[model samples]
Target: MSTQPEHGADKRRSTSAMAPRNLARLCLTYALAGLAGYLATLIGMPLPWMLGPFFFLTAASVLGYISPIVPMGRELGQVAIGLAVGMRFTPAVLLATATLVPHMLVSTLYVIAYTFVAALLIKPLARIDSVSAFFATAAGGVADMASVSKEYGGDPGSVAIVHAMRVALVVAVVPFLVFFLGDHGTAPASTEVGATNYLSLIIALGLAYLVAVALKPTPLPNPWLVGPILTGMVLGVSEILVVQVPSFLIIVAQIMLGTWLGSQFKRSLLVRLPRVTISAMVAASFMIVCAGMGAFVLSYFGQMPYATSFLALAPAAVTEMVLTAKVMNLDAEIVTAFHVMRIAVVSSTVLLVFKLYMRMKGSEIGPGIQ
Candidate 1:
C-alpha cells in the first residue's frame, strides 16, 4: 500500500516537473530575443520591436544555436493586441466597418482560390506530396494548420515551415513597401485614445481571458486574441470601455509575438528540404502579389488609402497585420475587421475548400479529416 501511494505521488510530480537545463535554455532564448529588439530600435527599423527580434532569432535558430520556442508567448501577446484593437472599435466605427463585410468575404474567397493555385505549384515546384501541399498552403494559423495536417496524412513539418515562411515574409516585406510607396499618417485612428483607465483595462483583460478560455473548445480560431477583441468591442461600442491598452504593454506584446514567430524557424528543417523552402518563397511572393491586387479592390470599394487597403488584405497573421496598421497610423479597425472575417471564414471552411480543390484536380486524394 505504501509503495503504491509513493508511485502515484511520484507520477503526479513528474508530470509537472521542469528540468533546470530546459528552464535555463528558455531564459537564454528570451534574452537573445530582447537583445535583438533593442538592437532593432537603435537602427530605427519599421515595426522595430517585432521585425528586429524576428530576424535575429530566425538567423540564430537557422545557424543551429538552439531549437527555439516560447511557451504561451504568442497567446499572451495576442491578448494584449486583441484588447488594444478592440478598444479602437467605438460604436460608429464598428457600425461603419460592418458595411465592408461583403467585400471582405469576396476577398476571402479569392484568398482560398489563391491558396489552391499555390498548393498546385507545390506539386510541380517542390515535388512534395499532395496531402502535404494542400495543408501547407492554407491561410489559417500555422499552428492550427500544422496540428490538423497529420490527421489527413499530411506532413505537418512541411506545412509548418511553409506557413511560417509565408507569415515571416509578409510581416517583413509589406511594411517597407507600404512606407516607401507613399506618405505616412494618412489613415489615423478614427477614435482618439481616451484617458488611461488602468482599472478598466485590467478588468477587461480578466474578463477577456475568461471568455477566451470558454471559447477554446469551440472552433473559434485564436480565441485568446478574439476574446479580448470581442470584449473590447462590446464594451467600447456600448460606451463602457474608456482606455487604451498601455503603450508599454503593447510594445512588450509586440516583442513577445515577434520572438515567438522568430523561434518557429527550424534551420534543420529548412536545410533538409531546400526545394520546399524555395517553393515557399515563391508561394509567399505570389501571395503578396495577389494581396496587392486585392488591395486595389478594397481601396476602391472603401474609398480608403491604398496603404490601408494593402495591410487590410495582406496575407499575414491578423495580429501582425493589425499591429502594422497601428504602427503606420493606418486604419486599424478596417484591418482588424478584414482579418477577423478572413480567419473566421478560413478556419471554418478550409477543409471544405481543400475537398473542392482536390475535386478540381480530378484526384480524390484525401478523405474527410475526422
Candidate 2:
C-alpha cells in the first residue's frame, strides 16, 4: 500500500512537470510558423502566410526538426477563414452564384464518379481493402475520412496518407495554374483592417462558436467551418454591421491551418507503406486531371472562368479551396458552395456504397484487403 501511494505521487508530480514544457513547446512552434509566414510574405509568394508555414513546417516535421502536436488551433483557424468567406457573400454575390447551382451539381457528380474510379484503381494497384480505397479517394477531409476508416475495417494510416497527398498536390498545383494560366494576375481587393469594430467582431465570433458547439454532434462534415460560414452569411446578407476581420487575424488563421497540415506528415508513416505512397501519388494525379477536365467542361458550358470552375471542382478540402479562391480573387462563395455539396454527398454516401459492395462481394474480402 505504501509503495503504491508513493508511485501515484511520483506520477502526479511528473505530469505536473510536463505541462509547462508542453505549453512552452507549443508556443515555440507557433512562433516558428509565424516567422516562416513573414519570410514568405517578404518574397511575394502566393497565399504567403499559409503556404509558407505549410511548406516550412512540413519540411521541419519530415526532417525531425519539429515534433508534431495535436493541431488544436486548426479549428479556430477554420472558423476565421469561414467567417471571412461568408462576408464575401453579399446579396449580389449570392444572386450571381444562384445561376451556377446546376453546374455545381453536375460538377459534384463528376467528383463522385472520379472518386469511385480512383478507389477502384487504388484497390487493385495498392492492394488495400475496398473500404480503405473508398475512404482514401472520397475527397473529404483527411481527418474525417481517417476517423471513418476505422469503422469500416480500413487502414486509417493509409487513408490519412492518401488524403494528405491529395490535399498537398491540389494546394501545390492549383495555385500555379491559377497564377500562370488563369486570367487573373493580381491580388484581390484588400479588406480595410482599419475599419474593424472590435465589439462586432467579438459578437460574430461568439455566435460562430455557439453554432459550432451546437453542430458538433451532427454528422455534417466540417461543422466548425460550416457553422461559422452560415452565421457569417446571415450577418452579411442581412446587412448587419459586423466589422471586417482584421488582416492579421486572417494571416494568423492561415498560419495555424498551414502549421496543422504540415505537422500531419510523419516520416515513419510514409516509410512503412512505400507502395501505398506511390499509388496514392498516382491516384492524386489522376484526380487532378479529372478535376481539370471537369472544370474545363463546366467553364465552357457555363461561361464561367476556368480558374473559378477548377477551384470549385478540385477534390481538396473546402477550407483549402476557399483560401485559395480568396488569394486568387475568384468567387469564394461559389467555390464554398460547390465544395460543401461535394463533401456532403461523399460523406453521406461512401459508407453505404461500401457496405453494399461488401454484401454483394460475399466473404471473399470482408476486412483488410491485403
In terms of TM-score, which candidate is strongest?
1
Q: Model 2 Cα displacement at 263 (Å)?
A: 0.6
Model 1, C-alpha of 268: deviation from truth (Å): 1.6
- TM-score for candidate 2: 0.86
Could you give candidate 2's per-residue lDDT for residues 156-239 as a string of tens digits?
878877887888777767766776765562433436335788889988988887888799898877888888888888988887
Query: Which residues of candidate 2, in runs, are more than 4 Å off?
Result: 1-18, 66-71, 185-194, 355-370
TM-score of each: 0.88, 0.86
Q: Can you give the lDDT of residue 50 in candidate 1?
A: 87
